[model samples]
Every structure is written in structure tokens, then in C-alpha cells.
Target: MSNLDIFVGETSGTAMLILLGGGVVAGVVLKRSKAFGAGWVAISLGWGFAVMVGAYLSAPKSAASLNPAVTLGLAIQGGIKWSDVPLYIGSEILGAMIGAFLVWVAYLGQFSAFLTDPQVLAQQPAEEGLVDQKSAPNAGPVLGVFSTGPEVRNYWQNLLTEIIATFVLVIAILTQGLNQNGDGLGPIGILITSFVVVAIGLSLGGPTGYAINPARDLGPRIVHALLPLRNKGGSDWSYAWVPVLGPLAGAALAGGFYQLAFA
Candidate 1:
């Protein structure tokens, strides 16, 4: 595929991935949405469907690699040329940001109401310094709609959780007998990939929301920082690197192992 095709495909696919995936979080977490408090099963399935839809739509043009971790893993395994990796990663990030922005727009009213609800404010701790100092403004609870956070707040453990979850993800992708493009699994493989995602969420998502993709987490986190929602809170920059680095590290490990074991 041409560079333009790659850019457009990745961007559109990743955008859709984040839109439906992040939209589920907003629907479940926001105060006024019909799906509010729908819980983690809903989130896991929603994200699985989101992956299926995005990959189906974007696979033709650029193989629909919506995750930078996927892109890097494929490159490391020689499924993709090194020269094309940057384009794929950039497009995924841009698409993720766009998808996140759309989620804010789609849930505008819910966010407004949630931010202003007295109970929400009342729930926030009176003291700020007690929390992660880097996340001073992140004391607000609603940020989880746009990004992942650790339930336990242990950096090493949180990082390991992301790594292990992502390692499972990338390894599955490599062994799935899907198309070689690394942008997507084919039709049947798409279904398999979605199921894999659901399994990861059901089995391993407890700790840090299973941020197995760098673009998926960072793009929305960047949007969370940029949008002007009232009481929206800090982007939790302190915890951001864990998701990004852990996924990448996991992907590298998967690629190296694939070379040694399967390639």
C-alpha cells in the first residue's frame, strides 16, 4: 500500500477503535448516561467489539494497525518494514486523539453533569498532597473515562500488569495465523482477535485496566489533558509512562520470542 493509504487506513481504524472503546467507558462511568455503572464486563465487551469494527473497516487499505505496540511488534518480527513503522505509529496516535475527542463530544452533556454533580465533588478528597504528587489535579474521579489508572497505585506492579497483559496480546496476534500485514487480522481472524481481547480483559484487566496499546492509552490521555471539561482533572502524567513503555516492552518481548520460537 502507498503511504497515503497507510496513513488514512491507520488513522481511520484507530479513530474508530478509540471512539467505540472509549465511548463505552464514558457511557459506563459518566453520571447521566443510560449505561452508567454498567461495570467492567460491559467495558471489556465494548472494547472487543470496537476492535472488530475498526479492524474490519481499516484492514483493506493499510492492514489497520491501530495500535503502536502492534506496529512495533510487527516491525520487529520483520512483518513490516522499519521505514514504515513511523508512519503507522503517527497515524494511530492521530486517530486515537480524534476518536477521544469525538467521545467527549458525544458525551458532552454527561461529562458536564458529572463534573458539576454535588456528589461527585463531595467524593473528592479534601486534601490533594496525599495522592501521587504528579497527579495533583488528577484527584478528580472522572479521568478514568478517558484513560487507564492503577487500582492499587503501586508503580512497579502496575507496570508489570500492563506488560503481562500486552505480552499475552501480542503473542496471540503473532501466532493467530492472521494476515501478514500486522494491521489487522482477516475476517475470521478479526473475530479471534476480539475474543482474545475479551479474554485478556476478563482474565487480566483488574489491575490497570489492561492498557495493551500505547496509542490507545496515550492518545486519549493527551485528549483528556487538552479538553476543557470542568473539574475534569489532571491527565495523570505520572502514570502515563507505564502504559506506554510496558506495552512497547511487551511487544518487543513477543517479537523476540516469536523469532526464536516460531519464525
Candidate 2:
């Protein structure tokens, strides 16, 4: 258990750093290219790419859940139509599972390579992981917390993080895309989301691991329990509800807020 603790703890911080690093690239790269629209599409695609790159680099293991509350918020906003949301959500889960599978496979490779190398595992020092590392800042007020990771593993903590993350994400998208300053650039909205994610991860992702994306959390979590790998053990089914419920709850709140603010 101590070995696993050191092992997992060592790499935990890597997740958020890569997440934000990818976001920075997304912001810088997407804006300059025409592959995606300039404003909201840019940002959505920016986030999507951020998710993809984070997933890619973190391959053989599930990358962090990119944006949990936003997925629920989009579902709530009807952005993912009623008829399509189920499929969207399912696809999201599948995508997340696949990403995790790859990342874990990669992780397992390193694990396999080191299974006999006690020295390697033992030498991995503390205070060297992403959990404590400094990352890019999210400008949005509510979003800055996302970059910090979640507070606790509790359902409510996850839920509140989701609420705030979603609220900020939506607000960022709205505030930027709808404005003269941001609307001109399509990805601005998504850039806004990316930073919001960074914010939440940096400030709020302590417990429950700031599962900002339901698919990112549950999908890979399910994978962790299912994959036939060495020393794989029980998955935390008890806390599964946090990532799932928190985002949805937050999205609902965002909807109310969105309605009142813009409607």
C-alpha cells in the first residue's frame, strides 16, 4: 500500500500540469489557425483538443476528466439536444474510457518495467508531483479554483466544484463569446473554458480528484476496476456518485444562472 501510495501520489500532479499545459497550447495554437472557427467553436475545439492532447500524452491511462460540469451543463443547456445527449454522453464516456485505457497501458508498461526495480520506486521523491506544482492561471473568477483540484472526495465537494466550475465555464463562454472583444475570436469561449478548468484543477482538485468530467472520472474509474492488470484492486464505487452528480447539479445551477443573467 505504501508503494502504491508513493507511486500514485508521485504521478498525480502530472495530470493537472499536462491538462493546463495542453490548454495553453490550445489557446496559442487554435487562435492562430483556421482549422476551427475563431470564437466559441475555437474554444470548444480548443478544449476538445486540450482533452485530446492530455489524453494522448497521458496515453495508456485515462487523462484527467477534462470538464465534468461543462458536459452536464451542455446537456442541460440543450446544446446536446435531448435526442442526442444520451448518445453524446455515451460517446463521451467511451472516449474517456479509451483515453484512460491507453494511458494506463502506458503506465502499466512503466510499472512492469519497474516491478522488480525497488530502487526506482523508492527513489521517487515527494513534493515533485503535479498536485503541488504551479500551473497556468485561469482568469475567470470562479474558474481559478478548478486548477487547484477538488477539496475533498465527498459528494458535496465534488458537486460544489462542479457547480462553480460549470457556472464559470458557462459564464466564461458567455462573457467572452458574446462580447466584442471575444466574439471576434471563436475559440475565446473554449479558451475561457480551458482556463476555467485550469483554475478549478489548481484550486479545487484535492479530493475526489476534481473529476471535472463525468466520463473522464467514471469511465476510466470503471476501466481501472475492469482491466486485467497486475495488482489492480477494488475501485472506489462509493465515491463514484460525486463526479457524476456534482457536475449535473452544477450544470442545473448554471442553467438557472444563465437564464437569469441572459434571458
Candidate 3:
């Protein structure tokens, strides 16, 4: 693929990934939505379908690397050129931001109602200064719709959880999810990868929401911070680095393991 193909494919695919993935969380959590309170099963299945759709759409153009962690792992495994890494990652981030913005647009009324609800506002910290300090620093009320956060406040534990979950994801991709040419996912591989995501969410998502992709978490978090939503609370900037670094570290580990054990 040329640089343009890589840019367009990764951007569009990652956008689709976040659009449907985040949309599910919004639908389940946001007030007045038909799917409200649908629970975790819906979220897991939604994300799986999101991955399948995004990968299938972008596979022909840029091998459908919708996550920065996936791109990094593939680069380390020598399936992608080093020179193209930046384009892949940058496009994924851009796409994720676009997807997040679209989610906000799609759920505008729900977001407005949820944030402006008197009871919901009553739970917020009285002082704006306490938004990040005394209030939830790990996540805002609706922030989970945009990014991952830990249920517990321990930084090390959260980081470790992200690393372990991401390791499982990237290792599975490196070992069994790639196509024969080693540049993209085959149909079977895409199905396997989507199910792997669902399994990870089902088993490992409780602690930290399983942010196995840096762009998936960081890009949306940026959008959440910038969006003009009332009573949105803090963006949980303090916990942001954990998801970013942990996933990259996990991808590095997976790439090295693949080189040592499976290559």
C-alpha cells in the first residue's frame, strides 16, 4: 500500500472502530436510550462487531491496522516497515478522534439530558476545583463512554491490568490473527480477532476496561477533554498515561515473545 492508502485506510478503520465501540457504551449508559442498562454483554458484543466491520472495510487498503498497538506489534514482528509506522499510528489516532466526535454527535440528546439531569448534577462536586481533586480522577460519569479507566484508584495495579490484557490481545494477533501474506487479517483471522476482543472484555475488562490499544483510549480521551459537555467533570488526565504506556509495553513484549517462541 502507498502512503495515501495507509493514511486513508487506518484513519477510516480506526474511526469506525471507535464509533461503534464507543457508541455501544453510550447507548447502554446514556439516559433515554432504548438500549440503556443493557449491561456488559451488549458492550462486549458491540465491540466485537465493531472490530469485524472496521477490519473488513480497511483490510483491502492498508491491512486494517486500526490500533496503534497492533501497528507497533506488526512493525516489531517485521510485517510492516519501520518507515510506515508513524503514518499508521497517526492515522489511527486521527480516526479515533473522528469516531469519538461522531459518537458525541450521534448521542447528543442523550448526553445533554444525562449531564443536565438534576439528580446527576447533584452527585457532582460542589466546587469546580474539586472536579479533579475530590471528585473522580479516574473517570467522569460519562468518560467511560469515551475512554478506559480503572474501577480501583491504584495506578500500578491499573497499569499492570492494562499491560496484561493488552499482551493477551497483541500476542493473539501476532500468533494467529494475521493472513498468509502477513500484511493484514484474513476473514477467519478477523473473526478470531473479534472474538478474542470479546473474550478479553468478558474476562479481563473489569479492572481497567481492557484498553489494549493506545489510540483507542488516548484519542477518544482527548476528544472528551475538548468537547463542550456540561458537568462532564475531569478527563481523568492523571490516569491517561497508564493506558498509553501499558499497551505499548505489552505490544513490545508480545512482539519479542513472537520472535522468540513462534517465529
Candidate 4:
């Protein structure tokens, strides 16, 4: 594929991934939504279907690398050129941001209601004039609709969980999902990979919300920080690096492992 095709496909696919994936979270977390409190199973299934749909839509154009970690893994596996890595990662992040913005737009009323609700605001920490990270280090209520956070706030444990979960995800893709020429996933590969995502979510998502994709976490988190929703507390910037770095580290390890054991 040409450079333009790769950019367009990655951007569009990643957008679709976040749109549906984030949309599901919004539906579950936000009040007034029909799927509110639908629980974790719905989220896992929604994200899996989102991945499948995004991959299927973009497969023919640019191999459907919607995740930056996946693109990095492919690059390390020599399935993609180093020079083109920036294009793929950039597009993925941009697409993720766009998708998150769309999620906000789609749920504007719900967000307004949730954030402006007296009960929800009562649960938030008081401003106390100026607040530091320590004062409100945890994510705000609405943040979960856009990004991941830990049920337990141990950084080391969270980081390790993300790393291990992402390692499983990336290694699975490297080993089983790549097509004959090792460029991208085939149709069956895409479906199986989506199931792998669902499996990871069901088995390991509780700790750190299973943010195995840097773009999926970081881009939306950025959007969460920037949006104008009332009573939306901190974006948990202190913990942001864990998701971004952990997934990249896992993908790197997975790629290295693939080179050593499978290549």
C-alpha cells in the first residue's frame, strides 16, 4: 500500500475502534444511557466487536494496524519499515483522539446530566482553592468513559498488569494473527485476535482496565483532560505514563520474543 493509503486506513480504523470501544464504556458508565450498568461483560464483548469491525474495515487498505503497539510489534518483526512507523503511530493516535471526541459529542446530554448531577458532584473532592496531584490523584468519574484506571492504586502492580496483559495480546497477534507474508491479519486472524482481546479483558482487565493499546489509552485520556464537562475531575495525569509505557514495553518484549523463538 502507498503511504497515503496506510495513513488513511490506520487513522480511520483506529477512529472506528475508539468510537465503538469508547462508546460502549460511555453507555455503561454514564447515566440515562440504555446500557448503563450493563457491567463488564458487555464492555469486553463490545470492545472485541469493535476491534473486529475496525480491522475488517481497514484490512484491505492498510493492514488495519489500529494500535500503536501492534504497529511497533510489526515494525520490530520487520513486517513494516522503520521509516513508516511514525506515520502509523501518528495516525493511530490522531484517530483515537478523533474517536474520543466523537464519543463526547454522541453522549453530550448524558455527560451533562452525569457531571451536573448533584449527587455525582457531591462525591468529588472539594477544590480547596488549589489542588495538587496528591489531593486528587485518582481519575474523575467521567474519565472512565474515556480512559483506564486501576481499582487498586499501586503503580508497580498496575504497570506490571498492563505489561503482562499487553504482552499476551501482542504475542498472540505476532504468532497467530499475522498472515502468510507476515504483514497483517487475515480474516480468520482478525476474528481470533478480537476474541483474544475479549479473553484478555475478561481474565485480566480488573487491575488496570486492560489498556493494552497506548493510543487507545493516551489519546482518549488527552481528550478527557481537554473536554469542558463540568465536575470532571483530574485526568489522573500521574498515572498516564503507566498505560503508554507499559503497552509499548510489552509490545517490544513480544516482538523480541517473536524474533528469538518464532522468526
Error of 2 at 61 (Å): 25
**CA error at residue 236 for candidate 2, angstroms:** 0.8
Q: Estimate each model's TM-score.
A: 0.93, 0.58, 0.94, 0.93
Q: Which regions of candidate 3 deviate over 4 angstroms? A: 124-139
Looking at model 1, report the run of 10 residues with the lowest lDDT sum: 126-135
Over 62-120, each residue of candidate 3 has an lDDT whose tens digit, in order, gives 97879888888899888889899999999999999999999999999999998888886
* lDDT: worst 10-residue window of model 3: 125-134
What is the C-alpha local distance difference test score of candidate 1? Answer: 0.83
**CA shift of 241, model 4, Å:** 0.3
Screening candidate 1 with a backbone cut-off below 3 angstroms (N, C-alpha, C), the clashing residue pairs are 63-183, 65-183
For model 2, residues 1-263, the per-residue Cα lDDT tens digits are 13332223213323433344323322322212233123323333344455434433322222122344543454454443345344445545655555455554434444344323444334321121112112212111111112222323345655676656556655554444332321111334434445665565555544434455566566656665666644332454555676677666766677667667764
Deviation from native of the Cα of residue 131 in model 1, angstroms: 11
TM-score for predicted model 3 compared with the true structure:
0.94
Each model's lDDT comes to 0.83, 0.43, 0.86, 0.86
Q: Which candidate model has the greater lDDT, 2 or 3?
A: 3
Model 1 alpha-carbon drift over 4 Å, by segment: 125-137, 180-184
Q: Residue 219 of candidate 3: its Cα lDDT?
A: 96
